[model samples]
Target: MVARIAAPLRRYLDTEAGSAGLLLLATLAALAWANSPWPDSYDRFWHTELSITLDTHTLNLDLKHWVNDGLMVFFFLVVGLEVKRELAMGELTDRRRAAVPLAAALFGLVAPAVLFLAINPSGEAASAWGVVISTDTAFLLGVLALVGSHVPTGLRLFLLTLAVADDIGALTIIALFYTEDLDLVALALAALGIAAMLFLRYLHVWRGPAYFVLAIGVWIAMYESGVHPTLAGVVIAMFTPAYPARREQVEEAERLTRAFRQSPNPEYARAARLSIERSVSLNERMTRLYHPWTSYVIVPIFALANAGVRLDGDTISDASTSPVTIGIVVGLVLGKLLGIWAGAYAAVRCRLGEFAPGITGLGLAAGAALSGIGFTISLFIVDLALDDPQLADEARIGVLAASVLATVLGWGLFRVAQARQGDMPGRPLKLDPPVDPARDHIRGPLDAPLTLVEYGDFECPFCSTATGSVHELQDRLGDRLRYVFRHLPLDVHPHAPLAAEASEAAAAQGKFWEMYDRLYERQDQLTERDLIVHAYELGLDVERFARELVESRYAPVVRDHVISAEASGVGGTPTFFVNGVRHVGPFDAETLAARLLETAPAA
Candidate 1:
């Protein structure tokens, strides 16, 4: 269910946002070091030569190049890993859910380039348009956190999905437009390295060392081929497999852990460790291992190296009048804002996609404005696109200025939105269309003192587990608890809507709970024919059930529950509301029972 996915994603966002403070300090330090009395030290220190040598061969670069071309590869690798994971099983897995953001990302890229080019027209500066095509994910999320709890979770998710698509666009531009004078032989060698990586994946080689060596080979080849070596990170990540933890693998891990608990042997411990590791995909494992290092260390180091532009009165004056600087400011600030908003608007209007529930127009515009904080990749592309020192400085200045202005603009818009919507912090989300015995499927006494409502999907594995927990609570609480089930079939579960409709069809025959149990008990067998089989097995009027399902007579009833769930802020399956208030955290039998007792009327 989405709740499982949201846990990891929330952790990722938190880590990235937490690192923003360190990144800010690093940027300020860079500016200070560049403008200090010992200004030349900043340049001299970063430019000091460093190299590795072998017999008749040397790999040489200055310290700055090492940070940019070397350490930053891990940063790109993390980005690539996130993109792959999203495409595999995260937000981007759903076409309808992803369409709006993906379309906005497309325009987010195109509009910035067009605006940059329109201002610079034709010159070396025109090539620097890549500078405005990205949003700094860390800064974007950090600023969003500043907007307080009034910001809906859906809006945060929308922006994160948009950022993923935006990252893909920037990576493609770097690999295609920025490279020059390709050494065909080295490029061919890089191709071979990529092929070898694919072969390893095909061979089911999960060893990190093997892939690490191949990644190094590909990075070196890419460097020699004049294609930005950081791209090798992306290439390696593409071949890295990502999948959810398999149930069988998890069961195997549990078995091994139990054996280890009994025997306490070295072999058992090692086996248990390997079992747990194999249960999770390599891409997720590596992302967890590498993301922190990249966010807190490599990215800030890159910032410190790249953001140290020597700001002086003359430099500021020149940048103020410079067309390149003006273009970058307008491109990132105005272009991203207008482009993202317009693209999202068009997608909804043209019926290509819809925004998440609870995302208002003003919130969308605020998110669009925040997309203009193009700091990290902007500075990165500035290095690749401009050879002139003054030009690069102007670009960096523009990037900094745009980021600050965008943050202010976003904050102001969010303030206006919160005021208009009256969504104050700590507002309790209560169940809408509160449970009614007449209109709901109830399994306990109508006048029970405690009420538990579940907005769940038949096909959700988590909901199936929650079903067991609910049965336990029913056994313990008896007639004191009134349990109600509502339909909220998710789009990812292809069979879930029909399954809900089938349950509704049975409900009309006065056997709703019977059909619910049968469906969850045989989830894999929920095809159209399978639903008919279930209806016949339940001893319902077979022809009548078939006719209702064929006509989709109960679809509106299921849809009404979905609408109510969304209005009540139920984003995922098996969401529980106890005594009319939404429950947070674990949904085990003991947890729910304890919560029910706490909320029960005093004796």
Candidate 2:
């Protein structure tokens, strides 16, 4: 799921923080190696000739080429998959979801590109726009993790979604702007290979090897086709099934659970046990197998192989004075911030889009500043854009400057926002149905997988589903999930009144979730007496509970939650703010899980 491959090529990269750490060390080592007295070794190492061929044809390239052309093909495949899936169901699934990030990414990408181009002009080395606008997730987060406590979960999620959307834009530019001439015969083979991959998926072929084999075919086909072979990874991705599982099918899975409570299929039992022995993997195995590959291998290889540059005795002005380097540095560090901030404000002020909660216009600008961490993809793109030796050199320097500056500035802004958080007053409200008494106020300094602010209605079935889904994520993530619930009673729901009252009564009784359970279990039962009975059943301090409800002790707290929901642009009930992303309906357990992993906290 993490892999952007249109067909889900990232299972290998997901679920492996240890591996990510190793990859980070490797990249740092490469940079250190390149800049050390052994700099010649760095240059020589990548330039080492590597020749490989089929029966009649051969390709001769450096070790770097193999990394980019060979391994990166799979990386691109995952990237391709992510783009396709998002278009189908994620942030870009619909026009509504696509509005904010897409617009932001457009500016994020374009302004920097213009800055790079304007400064560099048409020199032999001036054509590298690819490096100036990228934002590297791994390096960015690695840096952010250093300043752990200060980052609000909301701001982090906002940054993550922006990065995902920015990636799509970056890839598109590469495919459209950077490719070489096409060879018709090879192009035909690649097309035919892609068609076959789609056919296989359509045939319900779940085998990973089959996908891999066909993907290789596509890779080879594209390589010969003379289009940038990497894009073959992107194009074929459009055909991968986004909704790999239908809603009905997912629901069927739930119902089958109870049916199999006392009975286990012998064949399934053996398969399940085997899967667990390896690591309790499940039926939806595509992402599990490939996400890690894309995240770990593809990204790290790209970074290690590309992030090598020498700065011994070099001055900041060495790059700052050069047109290409200056352009890239200023564009990413300055242009990205300007464009993103302006674009977001324009859209929100015009009411074309609204700012997410815990976010002010200024806060959005701060996040945009952070988006300047264009490390991984930036370096990757630089190779494509600055084919000339001189411009490429400039690109390396500029990206380094911009990335560091952006990180520091962005972090500072976020800190300012947090320091002044109490100064910016907001209102939240509670709804019918309460929280579990055993679970309220469950927060700790160590808990940071994500901070979830759920604004839901008890009368809504989806909220009922969300309750279970949140619990499931909590169990899987342990103390990582920090949840704050708010009531946003939709006018359309009829049974909402009693539900709110019950939750309020539960808050009075110090058993919020217990009252919540009763309200949801019997959404159709919402009389005041019904609420009172649930309170007594919870063994509440009956007289004190009644008095608190009368005084509306929980009113202001609940109001803050509701206002926060409104700030996030929730048009309906059952909306949620996960790390600051306003995810609405059509959310399922897997989707939430994938997003959580995608927005996994730094470090």
Candidate 3:
């Protein structure tokens, strides 16, 4: 019963947008509760002591500290797993493909620190410069998702890789600069625990409880050794074996499955299940087990604990002129924008890395701007860097404010990009090589102010649906809006090539629109038999139509349409280009009408 309930919950938690929304709500709830009339209760609750006793050794810390130092260990462990996975087989596995984001992250780290130091060169706040260096992957990716589907896949991958690199830098800074007095004996114990973990791995020990015990010992040792215990989580995860289980194990699972099928008994069923389970590696299994927990529960709990800042007048006034606030705002909002773009640009120019497909300069700039939305890691560093409450509040405010602004800027830039996807100077959606009036099938007047070109496949369901919208547009706009049809029969569709040729054959008989409507009306049936029948129904010379189909006389027209579509960056069927500009917005008649009317001649 518990498994049944958890299955659906786990699926919901895996969705990035849903998880991000929950994180945002948690942050807002924290902010609201912290500023409410009973704000003192907020302080009291988090300060409540939590303690664990094991024999003579006892560990005690406040509830907030436990959430940050204890629960966050799992979060970092997930991050470490992702980094290792990427290094082994994902995008970072390619040095050339990885270099762009890596270089961008490198510059992104140094520029923010340099900017923060420039603002607070010698003061007590100078120690907190690390606060501005990290990018929060969750919040940044969330904001990009909010920008909608127009955000390119390449852009998303670039931002993700850049954030992962930034995290590596943040972890290094915490280990080197944030540590206090070191205890050599505790450090030695921590090393021993790590060594034991490795030795167990070497011995092929895959039991969960054994590893859990070793991880706890390492965390305790690191905590006592004056290094952050969370580092132990990352270190342990890095050691996780990335390779899948052996082929022998997989074959054994297959054999067990066959036995289970043959016997239909409990004994065989259990054996089969165990064999299949063992066939999956521990690294893959752990990632699947913990990712949802870290993303939805642990990260949201961390935000609820850390994002509570009193938003009263005194806090606002203090934050306005505070050097720490100023530095963080400048570093994140401006420094990240300039540094990441410049670094990526330099890498591309110097031939260190080439831009991935569909990544334009404008898109890269927008992604660089969004990288400034640093919330979780920024707040974490604020806690470690400043001891004074006032300065901490100031820095938090700046982080929050800058994050909000960066989200707005990123969204706006991408929206503009979507609207202007294929726009060329002095050309709206003009067909390249100019439409051959002698060969093309066009509806409405030739001299119409607006021309809507559709690169369509008759077999495509979407193109069939869009035909109605096109007809509606023509009836509404009359001679003012002209429509042209071009063939873009993708190879995936078995009958689309012949369908395109049949439409062209109809055009040869000066009955293109009638044949076009017939093809769409009977889209499910488009064989040579179907086309010949449609031609007879349209009163075309059956012999001429059959000859046109066999001879393939108008094949170049179809090929030219495909070439034009490719040059204009048309990626799919039913792609509409209006007045020479590719339309990236909605496909509905009202939106298309509004856009078309913009190109209408002055009265």
Candidate 4:
């Protein structure tokens, strides 16, 4: 389940990291084009008008506006999809887990705006405060990857969560503060379009074309209503559903594929494809489809369209004295660092939430420093807030300078952290807490020379499949190996926690291994009532089992294993620790046997 959840996040980060180079290149190209002899051509090309006409009505925009308002919609859509996913099932699902990042993000927004306003308090410059309020997630993650090769997963997750929340605040500010005069009729029409989309979602309409047409309508209506049309992407994405793959849908896909394999028929093939598509939610599917395009193409194009600023000595000399430039630099680089640090500190001190396992104050501080790299959205708001080319250029320079300085600051802090921690490069991957025969559910000899620990979920299909390999290893190794099983039930598996409790309930009656085997054997039938029935079949005290499950007697025990799993960098089910180190790659019987033999004591 962790693999299922983390896979998308990992992909998202990797894509963002990969695209950072392209984004940088585009920014550099834009600056060069603007500063070169062909600077007039740069402006003229972007200002060339393009129009779409339908009978009596027409929609028109210049090249730069099209890129900013149209192409960037997909970028915001990707952002919206990620935020929705996180809110629904990712790190933000747990309130305790979400509290610190949420606080940090909120403070990150407020402090920057306040600092910007303090410097440019009342006039047009103050209106541009939103420029400092967002962090460029791509650049932030990219820099983190570059500077800290072994940064703790918890810190990365914390920063990701903070970025999501910061985006929400930034988008809200754009909508509420930067919008032009309202067009009531067009706004009403846009509202109706959103309503229609919600209705389609309610009716379980999965057809892409239906949503696509409605999204276009909303975008058009928003464009006419004096609201940023890009927001339509966010609205549409918020209504798109996200969920883990369903077991029944997966099983059906397997059946269809098998049928297709048996007889070469297009009907079976189509059915298999449809079944596979239905197994994953539309939100996940669209994110996978569109995120790469946004990260690799649209965002770079945005940078190219917007990052141009003539960096003449006069412009630089003027910007050095410009309050707008000074405000943005101080707000983003200094304000974000201090604000996020304060918020995280307050949250931890107030006991509102604690950082994830393996995350330290230094790591959090490093992440906060990186948050000051507000390149993408800072330049984005520059266009929206400042009409004068000179002021906009100054703001752009401030944004670029803040990003460079923030990167250096973050790199320095991470180095300091590494040195202070005795040059420990990354989070420890060894088996945390170790195996205790008295507490852990162990099989084979307690004093066995070899130890194999598995952090597993009762309802995880992969874990069930891996049970075969475990059985094989046990048979071959006999008394030479002992296996420890720990519960790490995932949120996707609704019944897994209860099932884990059932095993613990059985353990209270000295049948832990029996119940563990039975749970895996009947993975599909792990309902509360089914668990009670399994207790009966196992010849345990069914009444005590049912009572303990009802009372959640073993929840703490299961939670302890989960905490230990996180501390040990276990991200998925069937995670094995051979001896004291995590096992990578295949977990087949042959692999496990070979690894165990390799780790065995000499002679």
Candidate 5:
């Protein structure tokens, strides 16, 4: 089922790949230490008492708390960015595009919660209804990835969206359902602090440290205000700039730049210069300053620290009987499958939306079952929601068992479906459907022969080198080599994506080749001004180009490229496909040219 739900993941986590190794190592390490003589040491390492404070102001917690509450905030912040993006442009952008997921997410969340509540109606675990409703996308998907090639792409994407929606709902429940009692005084002070920060934001003052200080106050308020302090992070995250889209700094710069031109005197030039310069500076700071540290480092560290559960001599039966254990186990296992199925079925019945073809109700159910594999986040939630040590231990065991069961069940169900289909032996099954233009080819034209595709990161030396090669090829072949550039910016390479979109915006003016060349030629310099300078250098009507870039005019273009690249199984930088055939091995100018010539028609 994990394989079916994650066709792409299986390849990533298979024996051939290394990601699965890390996952296995983590899981084995946890289980090994739990069953080892040093289980006590492992326990202490995770649960060790820890504290954070400012002389008069203070916060006290264990190592577990720091991971769950402190680090996970960054995780949620990145999630919020994804949510915001989806709402504006991606999967949830339109009601039509969103209906299937909305239906699926509702069922996925509601069913699990209802099931858990039914199983244990009157216990402390009732408060942890959210745990059952949640699924750990990272761990579960990573596991599913162990299933290679047998799964289909549509199913994988469907499950991915389902898990993402599940995450959003799970986060909401944590903030709303499981909070401390409200404290009005502290809450008010926290509110005031947030207001001060927002006021600064309004005044165009976005230095992060002040926001951090204000956020700390908000966390204190939440702790005192009867709400879980973690909610403070969610609340503050909602207000962060997904991209200050309305306040287009590039356009604002141009407004200043234009004002300077219109002014009759030299005074206008100086004033406009300052306006443009100041706006540019702020924009650059905002864009360049904030990186997604939370998702990559913070989340991984949290997983490493908190996910290390120690079972030792504790039998499954002993653990399962506890309310916390029962709650987590039933909630995650039964809750996920039922909730997702019901939500999706109801939507189709009510005409909200239907599942993608080749993705049946059974497939969805299996995917939902896979979602029940909620070890990572569920374990984290257990730390926060239940105070009883015994209860917490129970929750951990339940999480482990339920997550494993869910993975097996999901994988099994998908396999059954595949087998039934495969049994009809007339023809072999196709893994993925052709790209749907409306959905997949967002902003670009689709259907071109010899579709020369380039996968590159804007920041890599190799990619920078290849861009030149691609341009030369495009220029030589012209219409025969339909060049399509996709961004595969590495997690570590931050500036590459922005540079890609800048080139894309230039494409809006039929200057893709020009802008593309400029970026590659000056690979050493990729600052904001340099990006604009390249546009001007390419004679790409700088104001319009930069404005569109700031406004993300090519997001659809970027997204389409992303979808296409995924379909063709392109994972990293500098991958290419000549007419749908992949090329990963590096080749010199002569060898590649020879192959192209062999495939090329008479002049």
Candidate 6:
């Protein structure tokens, strides 16, 4: 029964729509519950006090506080992990490449707070400036995903980096400006807990339970010290390791897996499992385990608990002229759009950083407008910033209004941009230098009527899946289809270039297809050692293959392929060109066959 329930839940959490849909449902439910006949029950339920006592100390908090201060720590921890991963190994690893989004996030953060402060100059309202500084990552990404596949991956990365930066800015503000009266002893205790965690790390203690205890201790201490306990989540995640599996770790996994496949015994299974577990870092493990929980469960629960604002005539009347409402509405819908666009534009103008290829000025503006769909973090902040019930309700109204407006406006603008771009005359596909039979990797007759050229990365999951479809297409059209493969390794996939290089090295020995088949079959195990093992299985000179790979003997060919791909505007992996024209949509065997047959008469 547990397994049965977990399967569908896991499937639901995997898709962008599933997570977003849950959040939306929760928001609607909250609004309905809040406005229903039994409205006071909404407040009553959330305010029900819960207390924990340890010796002489007792920590008492309402149910809402538990969700905000305790459960939200998990949410913030995931945010921290994403930020660290991006900065360490993802898109923001390069300083120059990182500049555009970092600059945009800075502007995106400051402009809104400044605008909010301007609208609500003084008193209790001014303190709620943090409300406007948030871009709800879930909502923003959901809306973008809903906009369809034309949204460039680079633009998605830009928005992700921008949201992460916004999170950092918001957390900093909360820590610096939002704390109550400080308790020195409790602060010292929190410091001591953090120190203990570092000591455990130095001692090479990887036990989850040990970390949990120390983290809880720190959380309790922070809460007692008048600091928001959720900040501890970010602090702890910042210290988690970021690198991938080490050389020996990968080797061990390969050995164990080989033994398990050969022997099919419990001993081999245990060893292989242990090796596999040891290969990935703690950060990745945590991310894989907890990200879905935070996104689909914790965040939606937070929305359900906090998004229940009683919308009545009095609330509407107050919200219309309320400084908090006006500031947040203006800040999110106007300030974010202008601030992010201006920041990106200025960066490009000043040569600070160039925009991602295929991303235009209008696309950036559309993305900027999308950034204003602030729901989750905006609600979280309003909860923290407002004390008076009326003010809090007004702020909630503002956030909801702004988010709805932003979504509609941003969606309209993006669709318009897509239509405009589509309406322009289509450029003829031009592959430079033509396909050289000697240099290219071919799978079918050279004189085949239709040529399908693929720009692919071996380590990319999509490309690996695409290879299966390409094979199906090959089988379906034995004489009519000619398949050519080119290297276009993406920078985000660390092992992609190496995998491409390995394929090239195999091509040097006339076993390129064998290596290609094995790589895609074992896409999860594309480590260097595994690549060499695959080479050996294909009866290649393993020593020469490894040497050629290390020396990058085929680097020039791979570079040429990448150059050709760029010239043809291939911005992503698994790009397909059929009969010298780019195929714009799905890359499945059925689609390919239909397209081929459709154009066969013309050819």
lDDT of each: 0.88, 0.65, 0.81, 0.87, 0.64, 0.81
**Model 3, span 2-93: residue lDDT tens:** 11112222242235445788889989999998999999888899999988998998899999999889999998887787777667645566
Per-residue alpha-carbon lDDT of candidate 5 for residues 380-417, written as tens digits (9 for 90 to 100): 67766777766666777787788888888888988887
Location of the lowest summed lDDT over 10 successive residues in candidate 3: 1-10
**Candidate 3 displacement at residue 428 in angstroms:** 12
The residue pairs in collision within model 4 are: none
TM-score of every candidate relative to the true structure:
0.76, 0.67, 0.70, 0.76, 0.63, 0.75
Q: Report the alpha-carbon TM-score of model 4 versus the true structure.
A: 0.76
TM-score-based ranking, best first? Answer: 4, 1, 6, 3, 2, 5
lDDT of 1 by residue, 339-429 (tens): 9999998898889987765577899999999999999999999999999999999999999999999999989999998888666544337
Candidate 1 lDDT at 344 equals: 91
Stretches > 4 Å off in candidate 2: 1-24, 143-154, 247-285, 314-317, 422-603
lDDT, model 2, position 506: 72
Candidates, ranked, lDDT: 1, 4, 6, 3, 2, 5
lDDT of 3 at 378: 87
Return the TM-score for candidate 6, rounded to 2 decimals.
0.75
Judged by lDDT against the true structure, how good is candidate 5?
Answer: 0.64
lDDT of 2 by residue, 12-100 (tens): 22232335465567668877988787888988989999887789988888998778877777666666666665565444544643467
Candidate 4's residue-wise lDDT over 1-603, tens digit each? Answer: 223225678788888888888899999999999999989988998999999999999999999999999998999899999989888767777788789999999999999899999999987778889999999999998887787545765677789889999998998998899899999999999999999988987886767899889888999999999998888888878888877666557768889999999997888888888888888888889999999999889999999999888888999999999999999999999999999999988898999997665677888788899999999888889989999888888999999999999899988899888788665545467887788777799999999998999999999999998899999999999999999999988888888888988899999999999999999988999997798899898899887777677555566567567767877878788899999889988999999999998988675
Each candidate's number of clashing pairs is: 0, 45, 6, 0, 16, 0
Q: Which of the numbered candidates is closest to the native, going by highest TM-score?
A: 4
